[model samples]
Every structure is written in C-alpha cells, then in structure tokens.
Target: MESEELLGNLGQEENGVPKKEKKSPLISLEKDLTFYADSIKEVAVEIMMEGISLHPIFIAHQHEVSIGEVILNKADLNTDWTIQASTLEEFIQKGIIHPDKKEQFLKTYKKPENYMCVFVVVPQGANFVYYPYPKEK
Candidate 1:
C-alpha cells in the first residue's frame, strides 16, 4: 500500500468535520501487516529465541516511540510506519501492563511458540491480536 494511503486518515478529522467512522489502527494497517507477515514472523521467532516467551510486537503508524526493539520501520518514507518488538517484562516495567490487568493478560495470553502476539496501538485505543506463522498455507 502507498504511504499516503497508510498515514493519510489516522482517524483525524478532515477540514474540521469528523469522519463518519474512524478506522481502527489495526484495521487500517492490516494490509501492511499482511505484506510484512514473513518479516514479522521472523522477528517474533527471534524474540522467542532470546528466551522471552510472551513477547508482543507493537504496531503504529506514527512517531514518538520510546519502547521495544524496532523490527520494522519506514522512517525514510516520511509516513512513519513502525513496528516494535517488546516483551511482557518490558511492558510491566514501562507501566503499559496495568497492575489490574496483569492477571488477565497472563491468563488469556497466547503462546508465542504458536502465534505472534501483535499489540496494535492507535490514538483511539489498543488491542492484542495473534497471527499464525506461514499463514497456514
């Protein structure tokens, strides 16, 4: 997908009028994720090899990042699409894992060995989604 198509909307209001519906960051970036699935899976595997079992890769199409190891980025494009590889421990230290949701996160967390956990973040909200490797082909 073109960089403009990726970063153009961003859920921001256009011409001072709100969009009828704002697209979730995850939905907006689905194509990008699919396009980079192989690279994403490779990074997830590498993170697992590093001994961190519950790693989450954060995806956002904006700047001002200060966490996670950047596995994929397009800074040169001026579109600012980026994906950062992070671990459960790092999230806890950064307070991204709220104390109340810690138990829930752990209880419902999927195994990294079987799936790549993507922590999709947007201006509206964030969510954790899992994807299978090799696309089950």
Candidate 2:
C-alpha cells in the first residue's frame, strides 16, 4: 500500500471520524516549553518597558521549527535576574540552552549584525505592565 493510504487507514474509525494519534511524551514536553516560552516573553517585555533593567534567560527556538521538537534538556532560567543576550552562543556557553539547536535558534531569533529579538524568562506573579520596545532602526 502507498504511504498515504496506509496512514489514512491507520486513522480511520467505524464512525468515519479519523482517530487522532496519541501525542508522544516529547511532543507534550515541547508544547509545555512553548507555553512557558510565550509566558516568559510576555512578562519579559512588560518588565523591559517599565524602565527596569532585565537580564532574562531564554532558550530561543526557530520559528520554522515546531516547538514540539525543540529540546530543552539544559535550559535553566534564573527567574530573578534573567537578561536577554544578543547571541545563542552566550546561552550555549552558560549551559542555559542546548548547543545542538544553535543554527536554527540564531536564524530564527536574531537579525543580521547580531541584533536579537527579545525573549526571556521572568519570575512568576510579576505585575502586568505594558511597555513596548521602540521600532528597530
């Protein structure tokens, strides 16, 4: 049987609704990481806008890559003083992010000349604040 046909058969059910495959543990973990990453970004941006200096830590992932596959085995956030760095190499040397994703992370998170798009972790229960970064030149 062709691959597409075989896959269709695997998902078929008597009621005609395709049966969804169970998510692997790794996928579940990736989803969790994505959720946390978003939360951290939101909080970090807020903190950044309040005139408070932040050194937030983050595990940057490529936008083209599914978050469900990005590994976070070594990411460690300080929560208290995490600051956004300009390069993946900084995080990699600190052991806060995995080195294996260096290429994709750099490609997705930074602009040319090493300008970084901010993403960072913050302490839980931080007061909500609205501060936006000025448009990049």
Candidate 3:
C-alpha cells in the first residue's frame, strides 16, 4: 500500500476518504414480478437457517411436504440444511398450510413478546431467528 493514499493532495493528506457506501435496494413483495413470488417460501427459509445448506421444509406430519416422505424435524435436518418450518401445524387440528385457505397457520402458537412465528417472516430481516444458534459460552 502507498504510504499516503491521496492523489489530489500529492501525499500531504493525513486522512483517506472511504471507497464508497452501499445500500441494498428495497423490495416490494406485492409488485415484484421477477423470480421472488414462487421463491418467497424457499428464500425466507434459507434466511432463517442463516445461510446454511437448503433443506425441504419438514411438516413433521402425515401430509408430507414431498410425496412419499412424512417425518422430518430440526435435528433430522442436516447442519448444511437451511431453514425448516415446524411441521407442527400439519399434525394439529387446524392445518397451517391449507389449499384455498385465506390465512396461514399463524394463530395457533403464542409467540414470545419480541419474536414472530418463523413461517410468516420474510427472509430479508430474519437475523434474530438465527442469532441464538450455537449459543455462546
């Protein structure tokens, strides 16, 4: 690196200006017509898992997310696995993900004051969900 980084000052400057500031572009879920609609659930789950490997969301119930497979839990998901929403609802009386149902299964479980149901949150700002993982010493 050069001792003095300024070219305009010719080497007399003491402080160097930063390269640039960057901001992520805002996304509108409703109008976005690219690849986000079909991918919302998948991408959101990936964010929940904190950039780990991607796994299919395991409903942990009789009605499988995929055909032929029925049971998968957090522990069952591999370390490389990304987010996996609790299949907790599928087994319950009122199913969370039902076809033709207006609302998702957001009402069943009570959430702590600061947190939200993992299923409802978008992937963009969900660091809080994964922040507690591999808990500190």
Cα-based lDDT for every prediction: 0.64, 0.36, 0.28
TM-score (all chains, Cα) for each model: 0.68, 0.27, 0.18
Shift of residue 14 alpha carbon in model 3, Å: 82
Using TM-score as the yardstick, the better of models 2 and 3 is 2
**Top model number, TM-score:** 1
Q: Write candidate 2's Cα lDDT for 2-106 as tens digits.
A: 322212323235488755655433343344444445444554455456644233334332222111112233346422122232233444554434688666654
Which stretches in model 2 have alpha-carbon errors above 4 Å? 1-86, 112-116, 124-137
Which of candidates 1 and 2 is the stronger one according to lDDT?
1
Assess the local accuracy of residue 46 in candidate 2 as a C-alpha lDDT between 0 and 100: 51
* Residue range 19-115, candidate 1, lDDT tens digits: 5664554554666666667777777787678777546555554544566777777674333357777877777776777767788888877766666
Expressed as tens digits, the lDDT of each residue in 21-121 for candidate 3 is 33432232112212222333444355346643222222212111321122223245332122234433332323333544323433443322212223312
Model 2, residue 7: displacement in angstroms?
A: 46
**By lDDT: ranked, best first:** 1, 2, 3
In terms of lDDT, the best-performing candidate is: 1
